[model samples]
Target: MTKKTQTPAVQKGNTDPNTLQLHKDPAQTDAAQIAAMALGSVAANAMTARSFAKGTFGTLDVTECVMTLKQRVDTTHGGDLKHAETTLTAQAATLDAIFNEMARRAALNMGEYLDATERYMRLALKAQGQCRATLETLAAIKNPPIVFARQANIAHGPQQINNEAISGTTTTRARKTRTRQNELLEEPQHGSTQLDDRTTPASARGHTAVEAVEPIHRTTKRRRESSGGA
Candidate 1:
């Protein structure tokens, strides 16, 4: 029998969960957790919006309007929500940097801290502005006036009018072509010099005589060819 090798046991460390570790700060950790939670919530909401767009919510009550708005958001501002989420995540990393710097120094300069905080705050405000813009766009999508304006623009555009005219002309030409083809198919094919009632002999039943005759010009040409051959 072959001898089996035993795996080494993992070592455990005596570290305090609540206390800040070397090169790590508890404040930044807390900030990171908060940011993660916030981002998770936003992601969850976006998923819910997507479900609403799919008509998961029954077509009853005020949910129908909500569903419509959700669909419009998905169509028009698809990237907005993701961009906002990304901005928040980046800001969270910035927060971690800020807090790490604070942890490194025994005493931080108030002026510098204030400046960094202000800059971060501006970024946060910009993210908030983006969120607000997305909401405003959703509102516009839901607005009847805006919807009607879009419809009217589509209906009365010069290109649309030209397309309609071209379609009509094409349809008319197709119909005329079909009618001509049908007439050609229905008409009898016969040589020229059709026999008239006076020239044709009457039938035994006293019916007006109708006979297929070779064209006079063709008969004459055939006779000339035969004479030349002879």
Candidate 2:
């Protein structure tokens, strides 16, 4: 007959429920209880560490717990955003109720006691402000404000704004030149007179048509005086 080998069973210790042993796996029941509790990270981790020693977590590790919490937060955030309008509207309504209650209490306490009345009025104002803020938030979420960029004329690829400017300047200079020419035309010419009785050279030469020549005199004042005296 062959000899049979027997293995020793795992040992269990009795320690304080609030204290953690340096080398022991946490009770499965404790892990389950902490996991089911709706506690924050700090409290949860403290309780979980105290419950689970030997750096052993049953069914879930610290990383797994963190990931589970993160997933839950993500889910909650998505749900909240999905129902943001309804949630904000409900919150606004609640604030309105609170405002009304505070106002009613203020009205009742008016003139009887200054402190109580002031406190109630202050609370009522605070509630009214909160309600307004909630409604504004809801409105913003529903119809977000559109940011309209200022209308701009953006030029691309080395656009020359000065091209048009130069053309405009040229046009202005041309106009000025035309104006000067017109002024010169309107002004009387020096030492020149119109002779209505003058006839064309062709008429004078018994021809049908031809050019006429007019003499221009360049006389000084002394010569004019001598001529006038003569």
The best candidate by TM-score is 2
Q: How would you encode candidate 1's per-residue C-alpha lDDT over 16-66 as one tens digit per residue?
A: 322222224566786776566346544346445555755765433233334
Each prediction's RMSD over C-alphas, in Å, is 24.2, 16.4
Score every model by TM-score. 0.18, 0.38
Candidate 1 ranges beyond 4 A from true positions: 1-112, 146-230
- Model 1: weakest 10-residue lDDT segment is 144-153
lDDT of each: 0.51, 0.67
The C-alpha stretches of model 2 lying farther than 4 A from their native spots are 1-72, 76-80, 150-213, 218-230
